[model samples]
Target: MHVEEVFVKARFFRALVVAVSALASSAGFAGEVQVAVAANFTAPVQAIAADFEKDTGNKVVASFGATGQFYAQIKNGAPFEVFLAADDSTPAKLETEGMTVRGSRFTYATGALALWSAKDGYVDSNGDVLKKNEFTHLAIANPKTAPYGLAATQALDKLGLAQAVAPKIVEGQNISQAQQFIATGNAELGFVALSQIYKNGKITSGSAWIVPASLHEPIKQDAVILNKGKDNPVAKQFIDYLKGPKAAAVIKSYGYQL
Candidate 1:
C-alpha cells in the first residue's frame, strides 16, 4: 500500500518485461525454414524436423530429392535456404562458388549402402546375392548424379559382378526412385541407402545386405546454410538444431551414422 512498495513493484514488472523480450529475441522469432534435403535423408530429416519444430517453434519446410539435382536447382536460383547434401563434395563446391555461408558447412552423416529386395530374405547376408546374378532386374540410381548410385556401382565392382549384372540393371534418376523400382516389383532388387528401408536399429522391410565401408569411397553427407539462408535466423537455428543430440538420435534411428 506504500509509495515505495508501488515503485518497487513497477520496477520489478519493467525488468521482467525487458528480460522476457531479450529471451524471445535470443530464442529467435518463429519462421519457416526452407531446406533442400537429400533423398537418402528423407526419413531422418523428417523426424528431426518434427523435433526441431517442437523444440524451437520454427517450421521446417523440406524438399527431398537427389543432391545433384538440388545442386542444379540452387545454381538456377532456387528458394532453398539450406542444403543437406548426400555428399560432402557438393556442399564444398557450393562454398567455393560462394553459394553458402562461410564456415557453415559440416559433415552431418557418413552414409552407408545397402543391397535390398522387396522380397523377404531375398538378399542374403554378406551380399552374395549380387554374385548369384539370378535376379531379372536390378535397380540403381544414376551413378553420375546420385552418390549412392556411385557407391552401388563400386560395390558391384568390388563384388566382381558388374559385367554380369550390367544386362539386368535398371536405373532411377535418384535413390528414392531406385527404391521405388524394387518396392513396386519393377525390379527384382536394388541398391539403396540403408536409411531408406531401415529404422530403429533394424531393416524396416524385406531384406538387405549393408555393404561394407571398404567397398567404395566413403559417402560423407554435409549440410550448409545457403546464400538465401545466411541472413535468416531460422535457417541457422535449424542447422544448429540438427547438430544437437535430438537430431543425432533421430538420424541414428534411421540407420545413419553421425
Candidate 2:
C-alpha cells in the first residue's frame, strides 16, 4: 500500500511541474512584439529597444529594411506589429490603406543626410569635395526606393554636380547598403545617413559633411502601430517607450533630430 502511494505522489508532482512550465511559456509568448524598422534608424532603435526591454520586460523583435519594401511586406501580411519608416510617405499610405491603426502614427525623427567617405582626406565639409575629379566611384541608394538616395540626388543637383557625377555613381538598394559600399572601399564615397558615422555624441571616424536641409525636401521619419497590433498591449507600450525621454536621448545621440 505504501509503495502504491509513493508512485501516485510522484506522478502528481511531475504533472504539476509540467503545468507550471506551460504557463511560464505562455506568459513569455505574450510579452513579445514584432517591429519593422527603417535601416537609417537602426542604431537609435536598438538603443531604444534595450531601454524598453528593461523598463517593460517585453521583448521586441525588429526587422530592418527600406521603407517601401516594408510597406509592401505589411500589405502582403507580414507579421510586424509596428513600423518605423525612413519617411512619412510609407506610413501615411499605410494609414490610407487601413493597414495601420488610425491616429496611431506619429513623426518619430528627422534624418540628416551626409556625404561620407571612409578614406581619410576624401571629403571636405565646405562642399568643395565634388569639384575635384579624383574620385573613381561614388555611391548612393536607389532613388526610387530609398528616401536618402533621393535626397542625395537633390543635393548633387543643387551643387550643379549631378550631371558630372551621374556617370560615376553606383547605386545601392538602400541607405545602409550605400554606407557599406563606401565603408568597404567598393565606392570611393557615398551619400549616407549621418547616424551611421555619429555615435556616443560624436563623429568618431571617417570623413563626412552633414548636407544642408535646404538641398532637398525634409526627411521626416514616421512611426505607426499596424492595425494588427491595435489590441496588443505590448505593442502599445513599445510605442509609448519610443516617445519617452530615454528613446529621445538615443535618437539625438545618433545625429537624428527628434
The per-prediction CA RMSD against the true structure, in angstroms, equals 5.8, 2.6
| Residue 241 displacement in candidate 2 (angstroms) | 0.7
For residues 1-258, what per-residue lDDT tens digits would candidate 1 score against the true structure? Answer: 999999999999999999999998966766898999989999888888888888778899999888999999999999999999999999999999999999899999999999999999999997888887888999999998899999999988888889999989999999999999999999989999999999898999999999999998999999999999988899999989889998888888888888
Q: Which stretches of candidate 2 lie over 4 Å from their true place?
A: 1-30
Worst 10 residues of 1 by lDDT: 24-33
TM-score of 1: 0.88
lDDT of each: 0.93, 0.89
Instruction: Per model, state how many residue pairs clash.
Output: 0, 0
